[model samples]
Target: LRILCNYAFNYLNIHKIYCKTDNQYAARLYEKVGFSHEGTLHEHAFHYGKYIDKFVYGLLSRDYLKK
Candidate 1:
């Protein structure tokens, strides 16, 4: 996933990428690839008839370059 993210960032000339996912598994994967928790949108998402918080994670090119 890190490799894919790197490729995407490079391909798009993006300096940063932010991700929002409710899947805990994906969230953990994102963190493993260097995404840090930026903030959360409280009750910003609706799932299973209830509102759930959405976690915002981001990674910058500089941060990835440091790795």
Candidate 2:
């Protein structure tokens, strides 16, 4: 995750990276890797037999460089 962020910010020159997930574990992993919780979309996606909330996380180039 760190390597990917480094490449995106340094080589690709991306201003920001966004990730969306419905799993708590993934959300925690993103946070541990420097992503900030931006927002949530309630009942955004359907999985299995029910709708679930979607979590949005973001990391900016400047923020990524600070790590």
- The most accurate candidate by lDDT is 2
Lowest summed lDDT window (length 10), candidate 2: 58-67
Tens digit per residue, CA lDDT, model 2, 1-67: 8889989999999999999999899999999999999999999998999999999999999998986
1-67: candidate 1 lDDT, tens digit per residue: 8777778677877799899987789889999999998988899988999999988999998898788
Worst 10 residues of 1 by lDDT: 4-13
Output the TM-score of candidate 1.
0.86
For all candidates in order, the CA lDDT equals 0.87, 0.95
Score every model by TM-score: 0.86, 0.94
Off-target runs (Cα >4 Å) in candidate 1 are none
Clashes of each: 0, 0
The candidate maximizing TM-score is 2
